[model samples]
Every structure is written in structure tokens, then in C-alpha cells.
Target: MQGAVGELRTLSEGDVAAAWALEAAGYPPEEAASLAKLQYRQREAGELFLGHFVDDQLIGFVCGTRSLEDHLTEESMDVHEPTGTTICIHSVCVDGGLYQKVLQNSSKTNSDRTHSSKWALCETEGCGDPVDGQ
Candidate 1:
């Protein structure tokens, strides 16, 4: 894990290339959002897009939207209200070789926090794995 941390800032037009690269490395073309769509989301405040880079190269990303709904689906796309209800961890992807590193980093970041109210949701083999603890 030899890398520097970049600020997890809001997405911007300048980040489209990096974002597209991250998505291409993780998902199929049809499943990933276009750079324009991502930029639009950032402009509209419709989603939270965070990027993780190493040596100025994008290697991972986490994106989600705040919503009152518990889980996200296609239907949820129509609802853009930000209620701060749930910080849904919609998409989290790391370069194929860096999954473990990303997971460890995430666990470390959340480990110190008490497990009383947080619900962590992750996907494994296309199944939602919800864990309620630190």
C-alpha cells in the first residue's frame, strides 16, 4: 500500500477521465455511468463521488447518494431528494489487484467509531451483505 491520499472532493469536469477510467476498470460499459452524467450529478448535487488515486492515477472510487430510502434501485433514480437519511454506499470498486488494500483501509477508517448506529452495506457476488457494527 505505497500511495498518497488525495482529498475526497466533489466530482468535477476535470475528473471525468479519471472517473471513467475507474468505472471501466470495474464494470461493463452499459452498467457504468457516462462522464457527462457524473459531471451533471456533481453539478446538481445529486450524488457523492469520491475518488482514490495513486501516483496521480485513479485506482478506486466510491459513489452514492443521500436518500431516505433504505436501498437503491433503478426506481430510486427518479428520486433526487437529499434528506441525509442514508449515506448509501452504492458503488465501491478498486483496481482488481487492490481490493484487499481498499477493504483494509475502509475497515481501519471505520473501526474506531462505535457500532451503535451505523449500518455498513457491501456487495459480494452480487448479494447485499449488511453488517451492523464496527
Candidate 2:
């Protein structure tokens, strides 16, 4: 059967099963998050978690936290000051058949190796269209 178009949504407690299912399908068994961690992130403030669903079933996710730590700065800070947002894509996976399509559509262009977390923002703003499948 042909897979349906994927939809994006903020992950919620109700989606634990679907999320775990996707994790099982996408990664090795040892890597999947326990249900408790999933629930905690959903309730945590300033945490951003997004999932891709096909016909109401979770198929992929991009979860991250905003931190004040500068990835490029090695110097220790005396006092922590929140700076620009850091969006870490914990994972991005799709069914085997759709891997190429997902990669083509989801990758970010002009990605700075110094700041990997900015890719999510770049992809969202369409800043790097070269990698996106038009």
C-alpha cells in the first residue's frame, strides 16, 4: 500500500505508543526512548518536540532543547546567560522506502558545522532550498 502524506505535529502524552513504534521502526532497539522520558519532555517548558505522522501514526520525530551554551565557545562562563536558541535534532528517521525522499526534503543547506542545531531553524525558514526537494 502507498504511504499517505506525512503531517507534522507537536508531540503529546497521547502519542507515546505511536512515537515508540516509529522509534522501533527507525532505530536499533537499544536507542528508543523510554515512555517516561517522552512524557517528561512533553511537559517540560522550553522544550520543542515535533513528530511526523502518516495516517495518525508517528513515523518520525525531531526533538530538541534550547540551551544557553555556545557550542563554539570552549571558555567557561562564570554566570550562565541564555543566548540564542539551540535546537538539537535528536533524531530524524523514516521508513526504509522513504529514506531518500525524507533526506532530500529534510536536509538543510548552508549548514554551519560550528552550529549544528541551527539546521532546524534553517530548514523551517526555507533558507536552504537547494537541499529541499522542490
Candidate 3:
């Protein structure tokens, strides 16, 4: 699925490899997640992982999971909870040197979280929406 600004699509089963490449490139070896971990995140909570593409080529991504945990941890890197209230951002990697390794910030309580919450800004003419599996 292509968006108005390049493509703003969520990562799918077939996109694990590409997502892994981005992770490895943006994160240190110790900080980077294993392929299996990445796969689980995509399978379990992929809706939170959005990819950016130029001409259908993936150049960056924003990924995370739902969790009650307040802070980023090695364990959080491998887990996702669907019913979790807090959005634990795992990573945000942009090709233009704007790579945020892990969402190191502690979680905050939110009773009114919605999809409209701006995560990644899709830079294109009138295209700020992100595409999920829907």
C-alpha cells in the first residue's frame, strides 16, 4: 500500500528481512534485536510498525509495541502486549540520519490513546496518514 507521501505502510510477514536490515543499520549490535524477535513483534503487534518507502523502496521505519512497562529494557525489546495500555516505542529509523535507536523514555499513562497520535511524519503533499493492515 502506497501513501501520498512516498509509502506509509505497516511491516508485514514478508517484510521481516527488510525491517531487520533497518534495525541492524540503525542500532548497535547489542541494541539491535534478533531476527526472531523482530518477527515476533511484526506478527504479534505489527500494527505499530510503520514503514516509509520512496518509489516502493523501504528507507525508514517506526516500530513499537503495547505494554504496561514504563521504561525501555532488553526484555521490552522482545515483548508486545495487545491489551497493554502504554505504547512502548521500540525504534524509529529514518534514512536521513534521523535514527532513534530505542524509545528510551519511560512510559506515560494515557486514557485516550488513538491512532491519530503522530508518530512518524510522512513528508508528502497532503499525506500524513499511515497505512495499517487495513
**Best-performing candidate as measured by TM-score:** 3
At residue 119, what lDDT does model 1 achieve?
32
Model 2 poorest 10 in a row by lDDT: 72-81
Name the weakest run of 10 consecutive residues (lDDT summed) in model 1. 111-120
Off by over 4 Å in 1: 1-10, 45-47, 77-79, 103-134
Q: Candidate 2's residue-wise lDDT over 1-134, tens digit each?
A: 26577775677778766666665676666665565655555565213456667777666665434335433121211122234343433445565456555444434321221243443222222232111111
Q: Rank the candidates by TM-score, best first.
A: 3, 1, 2
lDDT of 3 by residue, 40-134 (tens): 88888877776767677677776777655444444555677676544556666666553442222111111122332323222222322322211
**Regions of model 2 farther than 4 Å from truth:** 1-3, 45-47, 72-84, 100-134
C-alpha root-mean-square deviation, each candidate: 4.4, 8.7, 10.1
TM-score of each: 0.63, 0.56, 0.66
Those runs of model 3 whose alpha carbons end farther than 4 Å from true positions after fitting are 1-4, 70-74, 98-134
Indicate whether candidate 2 or candidate 3 has the larger lDDT.
3
Selected candidate, larger lDDT, 1 vs 2: 1
Pick by lDDT: which candidate is best? 3
Per-residue lDDT of model 1, residues 1-134, tens digit only: 36556433345567667777776668777666667656655555433555566666667766554445555434333344455344445456777467666555554443342122233354532433334434
Say which prediction, candidate 1 or candidate 3, comes out ahead on lDDT: 3
At residue 49, candidate 2 shows an lDDT of 55
Reference-based lDDT, each prediction: 0.53, 0.47, 0.58
Q: How does model 1 fare in lDDT?
A: 0.53
